[model samples]
Target chain A: MLKISGINASYGKIQVLKNVSLEVEEGSIVTILGANGAGKTTTMKSISGLLKPNSGKIEFLGEDVTGLRPDQLLRKGVALVPEGRQILAGMTVLENLEMGAYHRKDHDIASDLNKMMERFPILKEREKQLGGTLSGGQQQMLAIARAIMSKPKLLLLDEPSMGLAPLVVADIFKIIKEINESGTTVLLVEQNARQALKVSHSGYVLETGKIVAEGKSDELLNDSRIIEAYLGRKSS
Target chain B: MLIEQLINGLTLGSIYAIVALGFTLVFGVLGIINMAHGEIFMFGAFIGVMITSTLNAPLWVAFAGAIIITAIMGYMLERFALRPLRHKQGVSHLAPLISTIGVSILLENLSHHLFGAGNHPFRASFAEISFQIGSITVYLVQIVIFVISIVLMITLSFWLGKTKAGKALRATAENLETASLLGVDTKRTITMTVIIASAMGGIAGILVGMAFNSVTPQMGLSMGLKGLAIIILGGMGSVRGAMAGGLILGLAETFIVVYGDSGYRDAIAFLAIIIILLIRPQGLFGQKIST
Candidate 1:
């Protein structure tokens, strides 16, 4: 449902994303697996229009969406749960979720909010508490719930498992799978290759702004080279 | 006599609170100290004077005119002066602050050219009217100013706490990127912040003009400096802090006038702010701005 073609993005004098291209099919979780400085977050930012691409095109549902601002992309049903779970710190949990539905004109927001509360009960428990006061895992849940509150057609998740405990990571991954099964396409960027590939249908390996490998998730999971490089398997 | 001075202090404090509210609102939403804010307040006072003198309008008309005119100016200031500098390369985070100072200078010069440097007195009908309560005298204008300031502050707090747009604004203040990703039109939110803030300044300006019976091109500087002190004293972006800070500064000034040397009012008021800052650093109601 989303196509990024040959996009190059830079921050001032330093070029980060160099001729990167990827496609996310509808109804599938497509993850970009990469190490530190692999331009995964940059790709997400470029797609979300937080960063203007130096060159190339981004198409969302066959529409040219390159250079559109984050808010504009959000209105077009694209939402990003950014790295570090950038939840609005000073806002209450309920207010943060309300913010997710900021651009909506529908009256069913109250219902959707109730649904979100049911899905993430912790958020409901802390609905009145300031978002900054939440634990890291709770904040991640809050961020995901905040993203989903927009009722996004395409959800871009950048490092949802970052800084969370392993058990919480597993839980978050399970949630991501469930979110994908519910028919919202997900573009996940992660350093956790095993969990990311396990949850995703398709995956791409990125190294230093270049996508080096692209294949079905299971195939890449067993691919000897990928296993060695990403899954931390030492070749004997 | 003490009660009279207390009332006088509160009236002045209410005016400062109104102006400081404008400063804090902009700072909260944009994270920039809008130096032009005081100039906007000055513009409001001039607009009040112009509307009253030229149009022969009532106090309400002048209030409304000042708000409308300064609100538009605030929007323009954001759109032109502040927003463009936001995305420029190598632009220091301090650029917007400095640019606003330039805007302030430009505004002061423009008003100086338009209205001259002399203090323009606003001849409100209620300026001379007073009622005695026990031994204390209360001017009708002072009561009006205090009531209006309180009403505006309460209304603002209500809007911020209860309304959807208000929540969006608070969210924007908390995290602009996250708010945008959640589908908030952050540009519009910032614009709304400036409009509301500038309107607050305008109202304060009109009230100040009516209270002291004088409006001048440079009036905003002194009041604006006090406003800066108020926000710093209260906490940079805390609404409650600004309100309390305003009253504290006003009371400090008035008490100094009553109990201490009248000439030491400004000095002592500012000294209290410094002492508070040295002690708390974050102001009374402020949270440390998280990185």
Candidate 2:
């Protein structure tokens, strides 16, 4: 489980997140849905320790992890598949995957790698190819597979479906669902309300760094205001 | 005579390659041109000289001492000189460059004050030993330098290709943020890169001292300039580019000195680099600098 309380973050003099708060329970997928500049990505960055918050607290499994470095957060099993799928472009597919477990000293790494290969067969086929040469969809898959390689308990996914084809987006959502079904808690940030709400158990609508609404996915999906703003009018 | 010149060029080229590799490694990982790198080389040579004369150690011991000492110095340079400027507003990039120049000047002056500004002779006992191979006479020191340099290059390549730490290094180079998210201690990786690069510079310095028979406080300047030229000519941040560029520069310099006026060697060599850059600005193996 993860808890963030009244966290305020900024980019220099400009404040992006003002007293934002959210929570994710164990073994569930929770999504933060927002339009552009709603501070969804900033929230993810704060939790992953890429950006230090100005105030408030972030707790992971009952421990204060506020302002820990990204590597420190990673060791505690928090992995973020960042916006734009920041794959190691020059590295080979296999090398990129190997980097996913850079901090692990356990024996399961090799087996986990094999499991990743099995799950993403395209990656296995291009094991020796450079990561930059992969297609966008393939790169997104590689990014997700790389995040999972750390054996993370809490996975933070930011805009994984952005800029992908509809078919590719559907495939990614399916994989996300599968990943969540495998018992890893996921905090997904998405602009794709319909798909995200379908996959996530609980959802929050973020607007300009504030959580405007929080409820069960189905309830939020059918809510009149949310339907008007996010989903549009339902065709009877 | 050409064969003799070629062999000599190979020896010189090997040293350039090692130094250029050091420059490329730091540039690749940190995206900062460490102007202090040449001073690290200079310091290594001084350490080599000190060990050989004061401690009366063997040549190998001098090499080891130079590497270890310079490596520590490199770590300190990153930690103290460069890292503090990393997060500064607006001038983050410029600060490291200017600070490294300051560090270079500081190192050069401190060594000058300590060792005095004169060329110290590195008296290797085997410098006199030579073997005649047809028309080309091969000295023991030349053979040692060539062999060691080649071995180091191969080892560096292997380490980068096969090791876990090397993978982390490449990841850091490719994307620092993503590498950190993947659990790589990027700060440690950056420090490790500096240490390795400085050690390479140290090795090159010692070998150059043995070859030229003297070490000076200002020796790193010209060698460092050549290293910059070589990396640019080959392609910045490309390991293979550094190797090829170094050998090319070495051969060109050797041929220039053999056939043309010796004084025009550095001028002609750098002119060739400029001409090549005009043709392909990315160098032989360089990718366009991505934003």
> In model 2, where do residues sit more than 4 Å from their true spots?
A234-236, B288-291
Worst 10 residues of 1 chain A by lDDT: A227-236
Per-candidate DockQ versus the true complex? 0.68, 0.67
Cα lDDT tens digits, model 2, B1-291, are 988899899999999999999999998888887888899998998898899887889999999999999999999999999787776667656788889899999999999999999889987878899999888898999999999989999998898889998888888887888888999898999999999999999989899999898999999888888899988898888888899988888888899999998998889658968897899998998876331
TM-score of candidate 2 to 2 decimals: 0.97
- With a 3 Å backbone cut-off (N, CA, C), the pairs that clash in candidate 1 are none
Model 1 DockQ, alpha carbons vs. true complex: 0.68
| Full-model lDDT for every candidate | 0.90, 0.91
Return the TM-score for each candidate structure. 0.97, 0.97
List each model's interface RMSD. Answer: 1.8, 2.3
- How does residue A74 of candidate 2 score in lDDT? 91
